[model samples]
Target: MVDFNVRLGLTPTDLELREIQTKRPAEFEALSADDSPELRLVEAQFAGKIVSSRLFRGEKTITVKKDKIVAIAKALRDDQETAYNYLSDLTCVDLLKVNKTEEEPRFEVIYNLYSLATFERLRLKAQVTEDDPTIDTVESVWPNANWNEREVFDMFGITFNNHSDLRRILMPDDWVGNPLRKDYPLGGEEVEFTYNVRGR
Candidate 1:
């Protein structure tokens, strides 16, 4: 028999595995506001913008209003203290079945940012309603958001306003329905080809 753990370098040293085995689940509670400098910076700068914030398992997520996403993103990237200059990833989540209130939006767009200077990371979320599934683009702040926003548009049917060259990146131009939505029908469908299968 082969020792895959040693081969793959998965062996833990300094009692790492022992610590994980003895850890308590109760230690995963949300951290206080003072514990997160990023949350404090956002709240202090953009008053009334943050809807909610939580720091759990060393990850900080701040939920903000949909309309203010662009402005907030710009500020965070430019701020000397925060300097969240790296746009690590931008994606969306379907919250139709999980929504607790009628007023809650059906979609939530998440922005993962990292600050190279501070060596810290933060996540920002903005809710989007099915009625108007649109929000301002963060491409102005982070140019790489162009493709990330496009992928979200293609998969989740959420529009990023003023995104340069906003179009389907993964799906065909004429493809109907966003595939990543929870409500999107499963299973394959018959696709009508615009071009001949064999060369004429």
Candidate 2:
């Protein structure tokens, strides 16, 4: 057995420092709608189509929309005011609220938007159903969304409408169902381990 000192790479002094340090959520806030370039791009491109807009934690903001996500994205990337040239990362999360189906989907699709020039970040989100999870693809704005959308599609089963090519990126081409749905089961681990691991 490894000693406590050897088990953890951190020294006792390091642990003491960590224990004394008070941790708190980051105090990040986004710019106001009137002052934010992202909002201006939204007004210019989407006009009254935006459903609602709000700022959260002051670091990021969200603009809910009901139509033409692709078009709005294109304008944001091209416009000088909101030159969101970098698609930093794309991912999804499971709310696990069962109502997020045909009846209701407590599930939410969160989009993290960032700009290299402005050094600002925003979140664009849409609600979707589990039965027919569909959202517009941002691939037109960022070609990289081609694979990002596919990852969301493969794991969470959220369909991206108008995606140039929709296929599994991490899973096999003919994967049967979304693996990240929170119900796919942990059945494969033992089977995979027994098949591959040679007993000592």
The most accurate candidate by lDDT is 1
Summarize candidate 2's per-residue lDDT along 1-200 as a digit string, tens digits: 22433444556565456456676754545446687777777876677766556666565555455356777777778888778788776777766733333544534566677889988787766666566678888877888878888888888888888889988889888667677776553232222454586663
Candidate 1: residue 110 Cα off by (Å)? 0.4
Mind giving the per-residue lDDT tens digits that candidate 1 earns over 1-200? 24434444554663245545654553345546677767777787788987777777788889888888888898888888889999999999998656268887788899999999998999899988899999999988999999999999999988888888999999999988888886654443444486746674
Q: Which residue pairs collide in model 2, if any?
A: 28-59, 29-58, 29-59, 30-58, 30-59, 99-104, 100-104, 100-105, 100-106, 101-104
C-alpha TM-scores of all predictions: 0.78, 0.66
Best by TM-score: 1
Candidate 2 residue-wise lDDT at 85: 81
